[model samples]
Target: MWRTQKTLLAALMAASFTILTALDFCQSTECQSYDNVPLNAEMSTQTVTSRWKNVSVSNTVQDMDYFRVSCKKLLEVFPVDVVDGNFVRTVKNCIFSKSIPTPLKAPLRLVAVSKDVIEGVLDLDLSVTQSDHFLHFASGGKLPPGSVPLAHRYGGHQFGYWAGQLGDGRAHLLGQYTNRKGETWELQLKGSGKTPYSRSGDGRAVLRSSVREFLCSEAMHFLGIPTSRAASLIISEEQVWRDQFYNGSVKKERGAVVLRLAKSWFRIGSLEILTQSEEINLLRKLLNFIIKEHFSFISSDDPDRYLVFFSTVVNKTAELIALWMSVGFAHGVCNTDNFSLLSITIDYGPFGFMESYNPKFIPNTSDDEGRYSIGAQASVGLFNLEKLLQALGPVLTKKQQHQAKMELEAYNIIYQMRVHQLFRAKLGLLGEEDDDAYCIAFLLKMMEETQSDFTMTFRQLSEVSPKQLHNRDFSQMWALADVSSHDLFPKWIHVYQHRLRRQMNDSDLERQQRMKNVNPRYVLRNWMAESAIRKAENNDFSEVELLHRILSFPFVTQETAEEAGYAARPPQWAQELKVSCSS
Candidate 1:
């Protein structure tokens, strides 16, 4: 019996040592060197579900009817000039390779699909048998014919300093496809895989970030904000390790890839890289290409077309920023690289909707200095435009350069005008009065001081009756404000009532309805996203689907109490969430 016990103890000790060694190996630098792993050929043969049988790999290019893929127009329009060789080089040797579909780990499970986008923009019948195949294609698998996947070359100012040669590191532009309406849309795969521009990082996005982006993109679009739209979200069986908090704590996370649909993936950084490299001809070529592709409304034959393009961009960007402010959105990282040339909200990283009306709120924990704070977004928009103007200096004459400066100067005025327009609509103020601007300013200031729930305050105000002003019990809107704020609220309400009285053309019911239309009943709060993400992580996607449906019609009030719970104040734990660049 003694001999048997000794033998068992020895064996147990040996097994313990083996387990520790394996764990050490996984954590070691040598074992974690997956950044440069070559693509596995066998991965291409991996099969998806039988529902996606129609989306098969085609031997003949003509058979690839999943998407109406077109040839590389951007490349064709601009040949391999001196700038092409020195400045805009191919991302990888795979640029010329005919088979460019980066293999995703299977089994590929579809987490979400935008049916509205499919029927509307894609012009595909959602009830048809081929719809499943189209959705499969949208999941980052089965390349369309004539697909030319290439990583765009660009650079930008990251955090107020020049960051050189930063392009689409993990993103691949799979050419452009023309919709049924003859409008072209670019389909890009994010978190597909690594490229030459990936640097030392493993070009993979975790499921956490992918889910956030997929939902937020569509959410912004539904909110009437100019933003990129998500076609589909696909998750893999593979596990990836990520340090989500940027701290030492590392955990294995599921991998995902999101298919992002956009008008164009061009950024302000695209021109910046060319200008900084002194590639003047290439800069002009890119500018001309952009005008031809996106800004075709502006005549390219005119000599001052570039100037007009710059001014148009400025106007759009100002309006975009105003919309963001009106909706209480804080884009955590407002880096120049993230600024879209078309003035749409492109990248959704570490973004947060303002819970409390605090202008100083910074969503990104990594942003120690509130550079991209809610209050600073307007100024940052101007700063990014200034950087763009610098990039366009080579193509513009001295007077044109001065004109660009003047356009940049006009951003503030344009931004204020748009903000005032939106606020006036939200407040149901018709025909702006002399004190209209002051009244809006005073309300915002009070909101900031009282730390009121930004979205709920406006939404609740839509239901408040003019008769409720006299009764304390009916003054439920004032509950959002502090004690000091409550004391000053009556004076503000008196002014507001006077303004409403001036708008006698519309009845009180009409005024309330107008306000309700402008102010959304629900916004994508952090807690709501967290709840959906938690359930998705557990392989239960019901909540994600629920939120998707609810957010699609943000202005509509839900009939059920359970559904209305989403519009309530966030829980305590959710208020402490630390979303960063990793998220």
Candidate 2:
């Protein structure tokens, strides 16, 4: 018995050592190194599913028949320009995963891949992959030279007024694939080289802009805003032509890379551009494909198909801008081309959240005139939606077009309601109401006057009781805070507190959770931008890696991390940093 006991203890000690060693290995290099990892390992891949590819991979006009075909495979796909360095390799498969669960033929099917335009389709075989894309930059190998897949066929509005021709100027849609869970998705290569859309331009994405996009996309996802996901970021060692240098050089050249992900890279501009031309047949085909690919739930027989589509897009854009307004997010370029045809958020150019709630925070260095200002996004969104109607006029009947125009006109009201609701939520108020707009305008006025920090002020608004509100000496806010008839805010707060009381059971805690989830503690703060730019310029992705980690759980506080500098606003230098849409 004594001998057996001693032997058991020895074995237990040995097992403990083995486990510790393995954990360290996963934590150290294996988790971070992308190239060295075994691609075939079950632990490395993720299950992908979706109906986006249920249609067809070939650009054939199969109508809805393309929806029935299924594919599953992973082939080692390389880049279009090998010499210039766009080598983002992955297995491409066609599976589209959106809001709905797609009907799939096989559970997990991995196959061979070969394509010229798309590098390759990858089979993600792991049960779970990293949600945040930073894992790749953190531990992965050298980033491939990226090229914007020349998907320039689409068109949309600009600043809610101008209808500009825009396409994937610095973005590439790699291919679609199924992950371990049988989900399908599109993996696009952004910042990859230029396509026909280049139009006398260099197709490249700078590391600074790429990092902002990579971090912000995940941050928005956490905030419950519908947004595109970032899969992997591969920056090249080579520089390209850029008017504004990443390191403050006024030169027209710099090194850049490609960002890969999945989504409808086809912007609203794509549809608008094609419609502007005489491609009537192609326009009809695209409309059919869109319904099958994205809005399948709606049928052709529906009397209000166009209206329904318009309304759906309007509400989505409305909610999207409202969320941005509440968060102080300025999309820098709210141009129709920048707006997703499908109403999803993409293109993080000169994007910034408000440090000061002035409503005119313009982050895009190129947006000199403040056309896409923070306060103006809602109206701008309405402008873009109106263009969608004008573009559809060529296809829809005069009567149908009239109806569509009416629907488009309603965007302003719908957006107003959403914007008001967001303000109430930020102020810890209850549901929608008629007087909501007044309360909102009051808050905005106060914020503007007090020079409140857009994010921090709203996150702290619930702390303001009438007594607290008074003590703060916000006499200016009181002028606007009062309701038209009922001493507005004091009465509203009375009701708000009562509502807050009912939620006291557990909703109080739940409220905090919900608000926090909606409000990210750390954004890719402008200062962090400089840090990411410097590291990326040096081909060091440590800063990028750290930024991804913080952005991954953007709602959670990460004080102890080395990128702790994220907590502060940009120093004087970040102000001098300017970015154009061309970059």
Across 1-583, the per-residue lDDT of candidate 2 in tens digits comes to: 2333223222211111110000121234422333432222122233112333443333322231111111111122211222222222211111111110011111111110112112222332121122222222212221211211223344555544554444554444433433333434555556545543445565566556666777777667666676776644444434565656334565433334333444456556656765676566666656655665578787877766766776678778877886776677788888778787677788777787777557667777777677776766776777777777766667787788777777766665565556555655665555544444544555455556655556655544432344554344344333223221233445545544555565435455566665665655666666676677786666576677677666667667677542565544346686666656656
Model 1 regions more than 4 Å off: 1-66, 79-101, 127-136, 472-485, 560-564
Q: After superposition, how far is residue 176 of candidate 2 from its true place, in Å?
A: 2.3
At residue 441, what lDDT does model 2 achieve? 55
Question: Which TM-score value belongs to model 2?
Answer: 0.68
TM-scores of the candidates are: 0.84, 0.68
Give the lowest summed-lDDT range of ten residues in model 1.
Answer: 16-25
Top model number, TM-score: 1
RMSD vs true structure, all candidates: 15.9, 17.8
